[model samples]
Target: MEQTANKQTRLSQRVRSIQPSGIRRFFDLASKMDNVISLGVGEPDFVTPWNVREASISSLERGMTAYTANAGLLELRVAISDYMNNRFQVDYNPDNEVLVTVGASEAIDLGMRSIINPGDEVIIVEPTFVSYAPLVSMAGGVPVAVGTTAASHFEVLPEDIEAAITDKTKAIMICYPNNPTGATISRAKLEQIATIVKTHDLIVFSDEIYAELSYEKDHVCFSSLPAMKEQTIVINGFSKAFAMTGWRLGFVLAPPDLLDAMLKIHQYSLMCAPTMAQYGALEAMRNGMEDIEKMTLSYQQRRNFFVKTAKEIGLPCHKPDGAFYAFPSIAHTGWTSEEFAEKLLIEERVAVVPGSVFGKGGEGHIRCSYATSLVNLEEALKRIGRFLEAHDIRGN
Candidate 1:
């Protein structure tokens, strides 16, 4: 009898090295339980706006099911270019510089694969996104995490970024209006960071999927900074800002050479983004500004209510300037972030993501997304209050 090959050994070492997402683990756990109030997932509670949905349906009616160009539909690319120019004062040649992707997630993967050589180090600002480091690792690059704390509202400092740079440092990945923490960087600070990147002669991958969601101030697009456009790869999509997560449409804006490299990877792997989604995204960019405003206002309202209620319940939460999350410190409970989250899920039926999963400096915090309905938010907050009181975890 022939000896069976070891299945574990057959798998790639890189695939085995990374663990499954911690956020998905909690989300899946909560999904299996009855009456569980989940604040774990970062998805919008709102559905795609009727106009945008209609556009996709219309495309289907027109029998527009064929594959688009490998670089995506030219019209959609034009719309994206126009949107960026009009809204953020950034310009890109749609034909050569923009590539529509499966999602912002795919754009990130492509960006890393395109630029990262073996052993190259990419600086990731964390407690930000979970996928950044793993993607870097998968691309044969090293992920160097630069942490930010709640005391500073989770801001990524220029000095910290500079300190982490080395001869191998090739790129820096930044997600502003950050996930989990909802922290945004100021233009002054970003300019400083831009200067550092230029001085170090490094590239930047700017994930601005949440750019349209800023509540307190206008978001500064990194690529718009003087002399920064050539060095920056901007990743964005219809998911977060337009409430089109299910559409799986995103785009990347970069210089022609870099875009050409990324497009080669995209063509071989994805071919193109969904054709119907492209039509829908075109409508969103052309006619969906009001829809974005409506959603942002709703998120801001929910954010305000959630932050206020969390503080009242003895959870010290920083008021988020953007996005739909409140990063509240659970330190007073005398529990690790995972411990508090797990116990709260079991005892209170309210599910939150452990802060530790977001990398270093995330301990003693729990990420609670305010993207659910007001009624759900209210019930979740009340249950959290009850759990804190029972554990005698009043704020210090």
Candidate 2:
């Protein structure tokens, strides 16, 4: 009976093939301990702006607790469209081209599943968000990783991307300012990539969840490039920039055909995004500019501090142009990425993620999020410095 039960309950090959999230593994470990200063997760420490929260509360009081249209509340979709145009220089018809989702994550998954077929190859630039490869694999597509190094500030080379392409190649996925590395691509380079995409006639999935958090230069939307709109799927959300991670609100912009395909999956699976969160997001879209500016400035300050401190502490780190992460090489310690992360967590009670989990070219590095308060960052840095000294890896 036991043997029969095991055989009948076998998991799907896709699910079995992927390992669990490395970020969540360390987070789970830290949750069990006391006084741990965690720089593991990329979530902001800020509260959702009062007005945004109040809008959602008001919706609940008004008894607005039901499902929205499968494409999301039309008002929210319109707001997202307007915001995209004004903020990122991108335009999409809210009527047919925009689809609100549970979060940027769901939008990405829908985009992948909507376009990818069995054996199709999607080029993934790494170290990137942990989800890109797994989601592609889950959608029955093959993930081809093209790694970038710190010497280039982790920016992908266009020639390398072109080399990775072939007949089976269907799409290319990119995130900037990237998670784990926090690197942003320049417009000249993006235009160069656009030429390659057009020449090869491929799709591009641009995950710009951190667009508002850029520290160096303004973000260049991939779809905003000339003639590239039809060939791109833009994935963005309010979670990171709006400090509304718990609200689970995100939206996508794609051509009408692709949008319709994703909507079909969303309707059957998710129905729509949460109703109250939609109202909250509506308010955020309308009056959230000041909040974004304030939060971004704070993050830039923290980024400056964290990068400087990481270098001073004997870890070689590149100053990231956007996002809140600092990827520092721990090669000097002669410890593998996992070993450095684990030992630091155990001895110093400071939690950071091992870079290897972010995929190719991530070895001998660790990702530290500077999204927490400056006070917490100061303390965490002190602990890290002490830990490094104990190991005789102090700065030069």
Candidate 1's residue-wise lDDT over 105-223, tens digit each? 99999999999999999999999788999999999999999999877888888999999999999999999899979999999989999999999999999999999999988999999
Per-residue C-alpha lDDT of model 2 across residues 1-396, encoded as one tens digit per residue = 999878756978899888899888899988999999999978999999999999999999999999999999999999988998897888899999999999999999999999999999999999989999999999999999999998899999999999999999999999999998999999999999999999999999999999999987989999999999999999999999999999999999999999999999999999999999999999999999999999999999999998888778776889998988999888788888999999999999999999999995788789999999999999999999999989998644
* TM-scores of the candidates in the order shown: 0.98, 0.98
> What count of clashes does model 2 give?
0
Alpha-carbon runs more than 4 Å astray in model 1? 1-5
Error of 1 at 287 (Å): 0.5
Q: List clash counts for every candidate, in order.
A: 0, 0
Worst 10-residue stretch by lDDT in candidate 1? 1-10
